[model samples]
Target: MEKKELQYIHSFEEYVNEFINALIAYSPKLISAIFILIIGLYGIRLINRMVKKIMLKNEFDPTLSRFLASSLLWALRLLLFITVISRLGIESSSFVAILGAAGLAVGLSLQGSLSNFAGGVLIILFKPFRVGDSIEAQGVAGTVNEIQIFTTKLLTSNNQTIFIPNGILSNGIIINYSLQGVRRADLVFSLSYDTNIKTAKDIVMKVMTNHPKVLKNPLPAVSVKNLTDTSIVLAIQPWAKNADFSSMSSDILEQCKDAFDKAGVSIQPYTIEASK
Candidate 1:
């Protein structure tokens, strides 16, 4: 029994020596890996800051710049991790394969998200609309507040905030109202059938020309669009800056009404009847 106990003690001591030697042999590699990790993290931060500065200097869009910076940082950190693993005598090819498999699984599971990300990339590259541009698309109209990786934010004219998925927006037709800097205000009015078409047109043209916000170079147009049974449909088209479109149109409407009344032009009236 004593001999057996001594043999067991001897085996335990040998195991301990082996473990210690192995630890001693790998200690330098472990320390180097840790050092590389620390320095690599610091370097990533420095690179991120430098990239931000360069983007800002180049006048890159803020949303695109932020997205690019974060993506680059993560990619660099991933490369650093692979380097550290390789330095620790681990096969990096297997690690990369494992990462690729995981990425594929995640991508498959989040296909919609990936599509939105791709759509955002396309939008940033193509620039159909920019921040602050008034746009109508996807059955919604609003000013573009922000363009994000997966979604876009819009501030509606009625003071509502809307988040539209980038995938849908990119695929749809975008109507950028502010892109041309100027827009046409189309106004229609009904005059009594007895009213002289030429006189009514002259009144509308004068009002449009006298308006301070209306553009004269395009030459405001007033024409008889239709002859209804009870009235003559007159169409007034005026050009104005996009920013002043609403107010200019409203002013023209009010001014035309006042001028029509003063000029003795009869306006068509609407009457409703109750069913018997």
Candidate 2:
């Protein structure tokens, strides 16, 4: 028992000495790694903050700014981790090679995602439309609610939320109704063949001119669009701010009917169902 105890004590002393020697040899490298890690983390934060500020100053979307900053922060942290590992005298070349291979595999698997990311970048760089803008694109007409990294959300008139992938959105044609700041309501009014064209034109002009939403500067115009066997088509063009476009169009149509009736102007039996 005494002999075994002596052997155990000797083995413990050897272990302690070896451990002390290893610690002494690695202490400087460990300290250096820790210092580098601290400084690298701080530098990464500073860089991320600068990037966010620059994006904000450039009026970049909040969604894009945050996504980009977070992605960069994670990438810097990964690089710092690799650097610290390398500083500890560990062979990181194989690890780096493995990481590269993994990244390539991930890239291949996420090709569509990468395309979306690229498209999102393009969207942010080029301001085609903005949040709250009423746009018609991809067979979807709605107000833009949010622009995300991979998808854009739109709130429809009926209050349905839609998520459109950025990849397809960027590739397809976009119709921005609100970009022009004003929209023109083109309405065609049909009257009986025997109705007086002069009196009808005068009534439409007066109704459009009196409406508060219609722009007076452009001076609303009326033209004889078509002459069918049963009716005379009159085209009424009025410009209104986008926000008031739909309401103005509806109001103008209703008021035109009343004005025509009061003026004893005759309309086609089906003219009330005219399409705009």
Candidate 3:
């Protein structure tokens, strides 16, 4: 019985010794893995900050800056992840290939988005329109609020917000209303056939010329455009600042009405057809 008890104690001692050694050997590797993870995250943070600082210092466009910063952070994180995995005795080539293949599949799935992204790059480089500019593109007319990689946001005059794809906007013809700094308020006024055409033209021209908002450099004019059986058509063409278009248009209409009344000019009414 004594010999059996001594042999049992010896076996237990050996087992404990082996277990402790194994633990001691694994502790360094576990600590190393933890360190790698912590360092990788720290590097990512550092890279993100650096990229932000660089973008801010360069004064890049807000949209572009954000996009580039995000891309940079992802790229740095990928590199760090690869490094950490390599340190853990893992072959990174297969992992990289798998990531590449996955990326390709996703890219194929988002072809339209990729096209818009390409279009957005061109837009940023060429700068066809800027923020706050009133533009007509892709059948939408409004003031540009923001330009992004996939779309552009606009706020219309009626307080409606619209989003247009960047691909369509870039490819289509964009009519920038605010580019010229000035616009023409083209209006047509008709009068009865009995009214003196020359007298009405003179009165309208005088009113437009005296208006303060009307630009004098382009030389405003009022001329007879067409003569129908019942009325004579006159075109009032006046150039004014873009910001003053609406107010000037209103003023011109009111002034013309007052002038015509004072001059005893008669406005023609629409003729109604009688049943046969």
Candidate 2: list runs displaced more than 4 Å. 1-35, 55-71, 88-92, 266-276
Clashes of each: 0, 0, 0
TM-score of 2: 0.79
Q: Report the Cα lDDT for candidate 1.
A: 0.89
On residues 1-276, what C-alpha lDDT tens digit does candidate 2 reach at each position? 699999999999999999999999999999999999999999999999999999999998776687788889999999999999999997799889998999999999999999998888778778788888988778888999988888889999899999998899999999888998988888888898778999999999999999999998677889899998888999998889989988899998899999999988887757554322
lDDT of 1 by residue, 1-276 (tens): 699999999999999999999999999999999999999999999999999999999999887798899889999999999999998999999999999999999999999999899999988888898899999998889999999999999999889999999998899899999999988877888889879888988998899989999998787898987887877888888998988888888888889989999999987755211110
Residue pair clashes in candidate 3: none
Candidate 3 to truth, TM: 0.73
Find the 10 residues in a row with the least total lDDT in model 3. Answer: 267-276
lDDT of each: 0.89, 0.88, 0.82
* TM-score on alpha carbons, each prediction: 0.84, 0.79, 0.73
Candidate 1: residue 252 lDDT (0-100) = 88
Off by over 4 Å in 3: 1-90, 268-276
